[model samples]
Target chain A: MRNFFVLAFVALTALALPSVAMAQSAATSAASDGNTSGVITVIQVDSETNLVGFVLSTQNGELVEVSVNDSTSFGLENAAGDRWVSDFGEDPTEALLRITDQRERFAPVTVTVADGVASAVVDREQGDLERNLGFLFAIYIVTWAGFFAYIFIVSRRQSDLAREIKALTSQVG
Target chain B: MAALPKIRLIWLGFTAALMALTLWMVFLWVPTEINQGNIQRALYFHVPVAWTAMVAIVLIAVASVAYLKTRDEKWDRLAVAGAETGVIFAALMLITGMVWAKPVWGVWWTGEAKLTTTLILFFIYVAYLMFRAYFPPGEQRRRLAAIIGLIGAIDTPIIYYGAQLWERAHPSAVVGPYSNNDSSVDGPVGLTLLVATIAFSVLFVYVASERYRLRKQEDEVMALRRAISLQALRVATTSDSTESISSAPAGGA
Candidate 1:
């Protein structure tokens, strides 16, 4: 029995290893693209100048300073390459200020840099940390609730089984 | 039989202590991730459930194969329990994953290879459970379920490597042989992950064993019921024969 489990483990591990190279290549492609995908570390809007400045932590871990002007368009995109216009208005400074006001710092945003300037800043869905934390809390509650529910079900079934056994024993006696 | 009393208490205490400590480490000991912050803390439990699901399904497949070879009811019981517990864990895994994805990936779900394949795996085990219950307990039921268990096991590797095999929104493995050094999330995060994994793994064992014992008791009850019905039939047959013999005219005449 022990050997059987060991064999199964080894077989499963062996099958999974072949895909490592493929994953490595994909990661390489995704990580090297700092111009487009990165986490927003800081968003600063200069009300006096109507300009925006933000720090982006690229997938490769390099932090880049991005400057945005009124021309930059805001939008959202997902994994399927599907994208849409953002709720934020066209003004880059206003959008940055709104994002700051909403406290959505450290969320991923798609930035299109052209000639060392941010041409587009897209909010990828609800990137607000507080909103995401609600989902996190929901996840935890659902998980623990599901677990306890399962235990309750098993306990109930056990009770039913015990009762049936008792009735059977009595019948036999 | 239920878990031995002494061992059961020890396991309960240990599991509770480990779980409490993991919760402490997750909320207090570990600092919020500089990048993802508090939402990222979900990883401590999410990753461990995923790992336990993988391990449980693997055991189910192996037990199924052993049952096929040996024809032992014990193996069948083990497989059933493993698969049942596996389904619960996989279900939790998918739920937590989707919750995590919404925050990090900016959507509730993605057709990203890893997420999709894991969903597929979850459904397969669920189907396995339904298939087993649909049939009466017998050779046919066991054999069919064993076959499904083996097939379901094949999905484990596919799910594990899906993210690696395709470029998707799902992040690459943080801690494993396949993890790119740059991709791994560690430090306090890593420590919490370790503690959570150990705690969940123990919980899996405890639950699986309880499920196994329940299955065994159920089988025994079923067998006893069958025996009683057969014996009652025999007694009724004997009594009817005696009544007819006694009611007939004297045999000597």
Candidate 2:
């Protein structure tokens, strides 16, 4: 009777898993477009002029380059009361830019371009396969260490018991 | 004792039925996947075997805890049986997974989470069996085995969740919808896998139970033989002592 119940329960669970998996898959498929909407703002600081400008990149891949005096493009009128001003000068050899999202979260990305290259190359330092391999190696070491430790403890216990058994036999004799 | 025979028969029947169903579902009912072709069929056995191996580790953990609490040899027996069974299934899972991977993953084996962890688990259980085989039957041996079993069982979840944790710690290769998709996410293929897992689990339980019963029986027979031999030695010692006393009397006369 117990065996029958176990079998029945297993069958029911087995029957139910497919439906659950299908529902999960359906939910995933519905949201599979993978479009994530977030604001990106870039603030470039020129050490030579001590001036800052902002660039915004949207989720739809639209890049909006805004200068300090460009108020009409931002739906604002140029007024004397405004503190914004643009300083037109020679391009600095180096620019330090901090890119922030709409929420003001900043990420540092350095862009470099070679001569006659149409595309600027961006580099972001992130975790890679070597780091993962290091983790795997750590796990392997810990697992083997624990395994050998257990073996050592077990062997010690066995020898201790054997000594105790010999002592008891000696007393009996 | 009266219920033992019935349980054995039921276990035998259950295993036979599960094996048949598994064969039918895997070979006939489950359709070959279009993307992976016939080779993907190995998932039917591989996944279930891995699942059963995990289940066996859990059982070993439970038995280990019970042995520690109760200090009973029976729990040790069960733990040994579970570990041995787990090792077998783990090996099968590794081999079958390799066979499936050769065509799909383009390598027979790689140090991936599933493969490496399963390999570690396999070695742990193999060590557990060796521990049992080397030790004589006693409370000390049982206690030692129980401790090892508990420790080995702790590695199961580490192996399982390692990949997820690894992904979170590392940069994902492909950042798209298909990146996180499990290979067994299809409808018919998922159903076939479910059936196979169930069948394999049931078979695993049946085999482990039978092996435990055999171990228990073997222990009992060994105990009985030891008792009989001790009794025979006692009888021989008494007869020798009486003969010595008689010879002393003859020497005095």
Candidate 3:
């Protein structure tokens, strides 16, 4: 029964991780692609003196303001998972509205800013996770947990054997 | 026998303290790798467990050979203990490796040579333990187990030299004689791994020795049971003969 529990634990952990692994690959690929990732916390856009408020994924979550022209473009992902740039005619008001629109307010976005002008912007639904600290912790937890659980099981077996030895020695005496 | 328990307790205490230090160094002291980032930190724990698992296999082979030569139950007991411990460590090694692989290699498992060998090693350990469990207690069981152990030792070297020979997904030896510049670790990174290895070694010894003690007790139990049963048989035979003598015609009366 104890063996069953250990095996079950191992199986569950294995089954649970594939989904996370898939997400990790996506997040890591995005991070390696060399784009800044964070949520577009706030944005103010107009034909004159366009300014967009953004927060970077770094621990500080610093808010950054980027200036863009009416001609500045936005990159958006379609249902087929292909990213396309938004250059919808003169005013980029509709594109700015698309950036601001999201199911989650802090939905991750990748942006390229050069000299305070927005070069490109892409919404990242999965977030960037290049550092991937979660996997590190998972490994540690599994490693130590396995050790501790084995130790407990071994101690219990040892106790039972000790009891048997005592009984057998008395019988022999 | 009295000293053994005290020694094991000491080793356990030492291992626990060293493990605490290892955790600190791994999580906070060492700088992150430029390439693998925080995920690379897994090496501190993963490599040490791998080393422990390999050590257990080698110990088993040596003990098995000793048992074959001297016929000492002590050696056989140690071999059994080592096999059991090796299975646990090997299982942990594989699990931790998988966890490390997902982020770094972008897959949970692959058929790389090093990994494949390690998996085989785990299975070999399991088989050894199972054989010991199911096989009847006697010289035959010990002899067969020793042979299985010696044969399994062949896989150990293959696992050690796997990366060097296959040049596959696994990075080559980083600290051994075969290590090269391409995969070498230095400074705090190397030091942390060294410390972790030592800590795990101490822990492995403690557990394996405790297991060895248990095995010794089990053997004692089996021997006592056999002796008692033999004595009872002899007594029964003697009583039966005496009764037959008493029941006879009393020397032609």
Candidate 4:
């Protein structure tokens, strides 16, 4: 039984090792460089000054203001995983401005900003990444903890009872 | 005496490995849902654990009925194991559901039909386990427990029908009137959910089997102790009578 457990642990570790290469780094990669990923808190469109911008709330609680322009690229994704986007040189009207008018507040986004000027706005379904990660980790921990604790208690009791049974049997004999 | 049967060990190892793989897929491979985002990943764990809980209660009910009909202690043992294991899974189901709800639903809990029914199931499981633990050990205890187990399973369907029966708020079932609505809920589970369900199923089976084995050994110990005590009492009684006779007046009472 001990050997079986050791072997199982080794096998599971080996199985886990291969997943590193397949890990999706979309969130991490998007967070790198000057790009910012967060929920949109407020959108400011100043037609008087011909300026369109929005305030982004990052995972760190830092609010960064981003400026959008006609030259800015747009990648819009809705709840169904359907996407609509335009290149940097293409018009942002078909994607960005229309979504700006119709979208809900605090929509998740990743804005590629150079000097606070948005070059690319990917308004996809990036969720509450940190809180969600915490939740998933918590649930997983709770599950394993509950199982292990139960197993430990059961095994210990079984061992104690086995010893008692052996001793009692000998006495009876 | 604490040694597990070969079949139980196989299930344990398989459950562990599958659970690890399921965790990887849930945390890494699956894409963040478009709407609910990463919290949607909770479905992988939540649904599977919930399903296992449901399965556990059913097993408890079935085992109880079998024990009743067969008058077999092994079936009684199985029902006990199911009750214990069911409580754990059911608690996890409610907890994971609450955690998942906080982010998406903006509340720790809701009065949605499915959620309410699942909570009821959890409570029933708890009540069944408490009854089993606190009650006296014997035919009476087993009979009453079996009755409870059989009845407790009734909540499972109530939980399943929750979405259709009254839940019209958040997420709708795939087959109900609300299924056609724009409820941006996730169900009709995808491949990851399927894998998770399979993993948790194996886990539930493994745990219950372990508990069952333990219960059997415990019964063995109890029977051994009882036999030893009875034998000792009989010997004491015989020796006492012999001493009294040896000390009594010759031919006198």
Candidate 5:
């Protein structure tokens, strides 16, 4: 029964991720007018003019410009699978600050385009991940979990044998 | 009686520290890959566990050979324990590899050379365990298991060289000094992988040793059961003789 549960857990985790990502992508596409997905190749910050945004290298080898403004929304999947969103609400600098704070350079993102300008950049890479820290945690979890589970099974068997030894020794005595 | 609590505690502490340091280095310190991104980080733990599995196979072969030569049950017990531990690590290696593959290779599994060989290796050890179960406790079982173990050891090298020998989807080694592909990993990434390897190797040793001790306990239990049964038979036989003698005079009168 315990083995069944473990197998179930692993199967669910393996099967759930792709669909979760697909659902997120579908939702984003449904809500937005035009969505273009690409890898962020450049970020230009000009404090002098209060302008800050990034450039994305699209799959078709096109370079698209994205600027953060007050109406712009920033969101990424956290390590716990929670959607963390920050709407700068017309403060382009605030939106840029949030992006810098949350994202690594060159991360893949899906940008919502409106009237030839980028509105909201959804991180496609982040959505694919279980969490920012999830992949690393998973590595550790699988390692330690497998180790301990083996130990637990061994210990149970050992206990049974030990009990048998004790009973047989008593009988002999 | 063999495993000292203090020593186990110390090793546990060290393992925990090393594991934490490795995790920190991997997540916070190592640079993310330009292509694979965070998924590449899985390599740090995956490769190490795979290496541990290979090492465990080597140990099993050595122990199996020693058992065949010396006929020491201890060696056979050690071989079984090692294989059990190896199976755990091999499973981890396969699962982690699959998880990493989906995002990077775009597939959950492939019948590529390295992957196929690894799957075969896993089955061989699993078969080792099952082979031990089919026969009763005796020379035949031990010798047969030892021979199978020695034969199974052959696959480890084939799996290791599978990527290089075949034009396969799996990449060549990237973290070790002896790795064929040097450009696959950067300095910090390589160092993190090295540390992760060390940590997993140490954990393997600890787990395998514990398994060996447990197997020994099991053997002791079986021996005690046999001894108790023999003693019971002796007592029953003596009581029957006394009863027969006591009734013989009455029958004669």
Candidate 6:
């Protein structure tokens, strides 16, 4: 009955953990979206580099050039005066608009817009199984060694019994 | 105890032949998967290894119970062999799973049901072996180990159903009935997996039987040595007594 409670507690704890993690991640993503209204200005776009340098400007005219990859989603106006969200996948050579907020630069910062918006970025990292393979392999080897070691130890213990049997046999002869 | 027939050579030949045929079917005969490409080929090995591991554990439980009932050391030896082989095949399943996970699931490890359960089961059996090692030879040791084995076998079902319990409580990403069904396992993939499973099962039986035979042979040799020593001791004592009686009469006269 005590074992039952212990198992129940463990099961309950395991069941609760992932829900907590999911809730935490959701809250975190929600909190990070508060500053989404900052105006993004395109500065320079390189066709070959697939890099779109853009400046994020607040209402106060502060500018910071952030390099966005081909996978970045940017809403832009084309030469045909049509609004479209362009990314690297759809159009490789779309024109990008340079926006200036009354800066002291004579030249307009040039940026190029790609064809389609980046759908979703999938990041692949070294996972636990691959990273811990060496450790797991070590554990596996140790476990197998323990198995054979058990056999050897058992055989050694039985050796005493073998001796006892030998003594009895010698007496019988 | 009488010696069991030497079927190891025949099993070896059969396993080799089946393995060759399985490889031929997997590589040459089976067509590549349209969706998952070449990586889906790993399913042949992964599924079979998992199945074989399950079989090995069941065998271990059976042997453990048999040993307890009969007190035959052969059953104990078979149980150990089955557990050892089960662990090996379970590891293979895990490794192959990781290999398949990289391409398919986009992650090498997940807190998924089958994988985690199998991992826990593997560790449980490892602990079982450890428990066996700590105890000395006797009825108590055998009985205790057998009881643990039975309990461990019972846990297998819980591990298997953990996913279902979790799914009931939480919203899953791949929702809907039959959303992730393997509709693509029509032709070669199915055949390859079936063949691999059969071959591995045959291999498991062959290895377990051979280990049991070796253990029985060791016991027989020990028994023979004991008998020989007893005969020698009896002859020596009888001769000593006869010499002592003859010498004592002469000394007295």
**Residue A107 local lDDT, model 2:** 34
Q: Candidate 4 DockQ category?
A: incorrect
Better of 1 and 6 by TM-score: 1
Prediction 3 global C-alpha lDDT? 0.69
lDDT of 3 by residue, B178-210 (tens): 111134588999999999999999889987887
lDDT of 6 by residue, A1-173 (tens): 22432453355345334433332333322211112223454556566644355455543576645555555443333334343434444554452332232122332222222332222211111111223333333332332243344434434544555466567556555
Model 3: per-residue Cα lDDT over A57-80, one tens digit each: 533576666655554555555445
* lDDT comparison, 4 vs 6, better candidate: 4
- Clash pairs, model 1 backbone: A23-B164
- Name model 6 segments beyond 4 Å from true: A1-120, A123-173, B1-6, B163-183, B221-253
Candidate 6 chain A weakest lDDT stretch, 10 residues = A120-129
Cα displacement (angstroms), candidate 4, residue B124, comes to: 1.5
Interface RMSD of each: 10.9, 15.9, 11.1, 9.5, 12.2, 15.8
DockQ metric for all predictions: 0.18, 0.02, 0.19, 0.19, 0.14, 0.03
lDDT of 6 at B93: 76
Where is model 1 chain A poorest over a 10-residue stretch in terms of lDDT? Answer: A23-32
Highest TM-score against the true fold, candidate: 1
Instruction: List, residue by residue over B191-232, the lDDT tens digit for candidate 6.
Output: 778897897677667655655554554555567676777777
Regions of candidate 4 where Cα sits further than 4 Å from its true position: A1-24, A28-126, B1-5, B158-166, B169-189, B250-253
Candidate 1 Cα errors over 4 Å, as ranges: A1-116, B1-3, B158-183, B250-253
Instruction: For residue B139, give model 1's deviation from the true position in Å.
Output: 1.9
lDDT of 4 by residue, A82-148 (tens): 5554553455445545456434745667666788888767643333455556665566556666776
In terms of DockQ, which candidate is strongest?
3
lDDT of 1 at B145: 94
Point out the higher-scoring one by DockQ: 1 or 3: 3
**lDDT of each model, Cα atoms only?**
0.69, 0.54, 0.69, 0.69, 0.68, 0.55
